[model samples]
Target: MSISATEGVGPSLWGLGATTSAKTQQDKDMFLQLLVAQLRYQDPMNPTDSSQFLAQSAQFTSLEKMEEVAAQTAAMVQAQLAFGASSLVGTTVTYATGPAGDDGSPAPTATGVVDGVTFGSQGPVLSIDGTDVALAALHTVTRPGIGPDAGTAAATPADD
Candidate 1:
């Protein structure tokens, strides 16, 4: 009789944890538990191959490193968003008011200089003329004193 390393493990092993850091720790713990159980219950007459164990260990290490890189990348992206939002503090921005009218009219828009930025779970919200506007709603950014055509900077949506 033989039991594979992943004989009973299923899709539940890939379920997400509460946070990136917490998820990584949880994954390591679960992997270790499975490895220990495999070692303890193996048939003595047909011992599991040592090379198989080594391969599993190497795969676990690779997964851990990949998780660390993902966490670092998320942090870097957040920092970039903060810096970009801050740079817009004094620039005029034209933003959509809402969806287009049901009568086929274009969507209403409002323009204002961004006065402040507030970070939330959804990303940065710009305070434009005292109104809170999502970064995605912005259409164009223009320097305060420049003409509309010459100063218009294309708006880019933030990644969700």
Candidate 2:
């Protein structure tokens, strides 16, 4: 009988240890444990290379650093969006309403004062005339005094 790597052999106890499903820090610890076990139980006649262990450790470190950078970048972008959206308060904006179908018809637009800015799961959403409009739905944004029709005053502060 031939035993394979997946057969829970000494090293298989750790598995490949790389998976998208294992997102938590505990998963990383388990993977590290597997690596250490593999090194400890390696055949004495053909010991594992120190350089290989170093490379794997470096790779894991790099992955962690990259994930941190990505998280920071996402936070920065969200901050920028919040700042930009807040500036829209008291300003007039024309935004598309409802889904735009494939009929090539002109999308209906509504103009109102930006009551407040809120964050949704996807990104920034604006409160326009008591409606939640996505930032992407905006067609135009104009200062209150610059346009022929000034923006309507916001009725009240937005709900949390």
Candidate 3:
């Protein structure tokens, strides 16, 4: 006998009306939990057939994998945040090389922390105690608290 078309794919036991909002990460978890409970209490005589059960199991597994990937992404973002944070420590910068600082004297280097992040991925601005400058706009970086050595790199010319 052909199984009913409604078999195994009908409204969930939680009685949520058919809505498209049930596809987000949180909803995926809830649906997996509900599917688990459904399997646990299904009638034995007409056991949830292997094919149907396996399909639902696959859905849950895929959802779990997506969650893992999301978690890894979050961790990578955190690590980048930490790296960006440490970039500001002792960065002995002289903002006196760009078109803005054309006289050739290094701008006053400031010692400070990454007060905040403004643009995304374009790099953050470094706030040295009292100086505010974009990391991208940095003229040169040296030891945490020392200006770039004029002897080793002053006349090398900007990288081609």
Candidate 4:
């Protein structure tokens, strides 16, 4: 197919740019096609190393598994933060996160722990403890935080 000038390229071998704008599956397809073509045209005297090929294949599989694990970890952290944030909406809590940094950290908003959540609104707004803040305001939501032990005195924190 002819590359259009408005599409950023006029002409090229394979009619494609070297940019990584292509999808992951497309990269996988190209890799497999190239591997097969190489195998079909390789010199018998200088054949590809079997062990090296197996190692590269293993690396690709490991990459996929790691990516999956990372995605799962992100989802878990988000769920944990959401649960922690929601649970705060019934307690009296005042906290401090940090100065809203150059990259849009929030301007230290502190509200009662047990407050009404705006329906269909975006971002974290409440604070339950020092640094145990609204998840949306955070760049990182840690594993559900363990706060002060309000044991046989007053109150236990977010251990649940």
Winner by lDDT: 1
Per-model TM against the reference: 0.72, 0.70, 0.40, 0.50
lDDT of each: 0.84, 0.78, 0.58, 0.54
Per-residue lDDT tens digits for candidate 3, residues 59-136, read 766765666677679768767865774665665555532353577765554334444434345445566655656665
* lDDT (Cα, tens digit) per residue for candidate 2, span 1-160: 9643334533234333343234545556666778867976899999999999999989877876676677679889999998999899988899999777689877888999999988888888999989999999999999856766756676897899
User: TM-score for model 3?
Assistant: 0.40
C-alpha RMSD (angstroms) for model 1: 11.1
- Per-residue lDDT tens digits for candidate 4, residues 1-160, read 8533234312252233353235754665566566666776889999999986788778766765665677679768766666666765666654444676698866675544444443223544553433344445434222224345433455768775
Identify the superior model by lDDT, candidate 2 or candidate 4: 2
- Per-residue lDDT for 1-160 in model 1, tens only? 9865555544356443456455555566678778989999999999999999999989986886787679779989999998999899999999999998999998899999999999999999999999999998999999866874575678999999
Clash pairs (backbone) in predicted model 3:
90-144
TM-score of 1: 0.72
Every candidate's CA RMSD: 11.1, 10.8, 12.5, 11.4
**Residue pairs whose backbone atoms clash in candidate 2:** none
Query: Of models 2 and 3, which has the larger lDDT?
Result: 2
- Residue pairs with backbone atoms closer than 3 Å in model 4 (clashes): 90-114
For model 3 the local lDDT of residue 16 reads: 36
lDDT of 1 at 125: 97
**Which whole-number lDDT from 0 to 100 does residue 138 have in model 2?**
95
